[model samples]
Target: MPRARNTGSRSPARGAGPGRAGTPGRGQGTPAGRGQGTPAGRGQGAPADRGQGARGRGPIAGPSNDGQQQQARAPRRRRFRPGTRALMEIRKFQKSTKLLLRKLPFARVVREVCQDVGGVDFRWQAYAIMALQEAAEAFLVGLMEDANLIALHAKRVTIMPKDVQLARRIRGPEKGFASL
Candidate 1:
């Protein structure tokens, strides 16, 4: 036979429950230490009225209908590190900038290379593509800058293949620049 459980009934007495008598959860009704009908700030242990509780309207006024503090709460902490968030924002801006600049010439080739490589996870594939695109863009910008300098040195307004070849030669194998 199964034994019946004790399911005790609650009493309304001041010392009825788990906590100390004056504090909350000991019993129902208003908390034990507070006085009835006296305006707030006049109660036991309340801070002296800093001119706000005279009309019973501001910070010095005791706990309102609910028991929370009237002052503004502290700001919540971020779940991620500040640097990680900043980097994510920078990545978003970079992606937007790439879209505004028109499609990259080597994006298709990068995607093909990623596809041909084995053991590439889909999650890291986008990151890998972005990294490659950034490296390519930076390299092209540097090369163009150097080529423009060479063209200017030769007293020409336009950059020619020779200027680019000279820039590549100057960069050399040590810098990973290939001959045109």
Candidate 2:
């Protein structure tokens, strides 16, 4: 087996040692470790270089990790409790308001509420939530229209609790949302 030239111990001087014809020897006429007369920084015969540029690191590679370590994750926030939850802030946009219920993170809160009610395997699906949101909006709009009419018949513009109650009764106990 041919041995790799013992370049480790050689001092970088121009034109020193038995030179490889192409790679200029350290301190040999190569201009301070410049490979093939290009530049000194191209990892020619630089004593400290290990040719890291040829094959780069893996995905998620960092200076601290050299493929021997797993990346550490940041700790998760504590579980939601009523008192602690009150301090947290959540942003909601005006457009989503028409498509969503007030103060409700429907999907996550649906799962939590279902779990509280002892539901077995309650997984929240996006399409199901979206459909339910639309259905609720439709039901509410129709109900509010009927309630407003009842309030108007009573010579009031503002819909009262009694107006909604009477509207539900008029819509009846069998097919109405009162049964729901």
Candidate 3:
């Protein structure tokens, strides 16, 4: 039988050397030029050999390992004092409250009531306005209750002059009904 052919070799069947199977044959100096030479494989035997002294360097050294340890042990910084933070919160609340008051139409009535109650001081105005708003809310609730009572007790109803005036204003004079 014929000899089994070694298909892995690149050399012809005549005269091939031991290192000629996959090794770089001639003038290839760098490991990359060689077939099986990985950069990691080159650094495998001696780790310290591929140190900062290599051809291509990495990023500059940061604060040393010791410096990082010291920084980690350093005291934390205080962002704000408790009193200062409270004051800031109060000021923000006041600003938002003032903006809301300005946008509300009924805020004028509340302000007028505050003025009548001698709430001239800027700081005291907020409390005075709050009181006026509460009073107006109570008055509106009372008026609604009276209207409901009148609607429910229709038999013994007595309309006031103000109600008649309101009705006359709502129903303007017709074409020839003014003389009557």
Better of 1 and 2 by TM-score: 2
Q: Tell me the lDDT of model 1 at 145.
A: 83
Give per-residue CA lDDT, model 1, range 75-143, as digits (tens): 688799657997797678667655323344566666566678954633346666677767777787688
Error of 2 at 121 (Å): 4.9
TM-score of 1: 0.37
Error of 3 at 142 (Å): 1.4
Best by lDDT: 1
Q: Write the per-residue lDDT of candidate 2 for residues 24-123, one digit (tens) a residue.
A: 5566643432333313345354433223232222222336543344345556777887645544432333234456464357666667777889867576
Question: What lDDT, from 0 to 1, does candidate 1 have?
Answer: 0.59
lDDT by residue (1-180, candidate 3, tens digit) is 565543444345323344543233345432322232213235342332232222325323445657768677879877896579877976786576333233256666555666889869333456665766666555544444454455455553454544444434434565212332
Model 2 regions lying over 4 Å from their true place: 1-104, 116-118
Give the winner by TM-score: 2
Listed per candidate, the RMSD to the true structure in angstroms reads: 20.6, 18.9, 22.7
Better by TM-score, candidate 3 or 1:
1
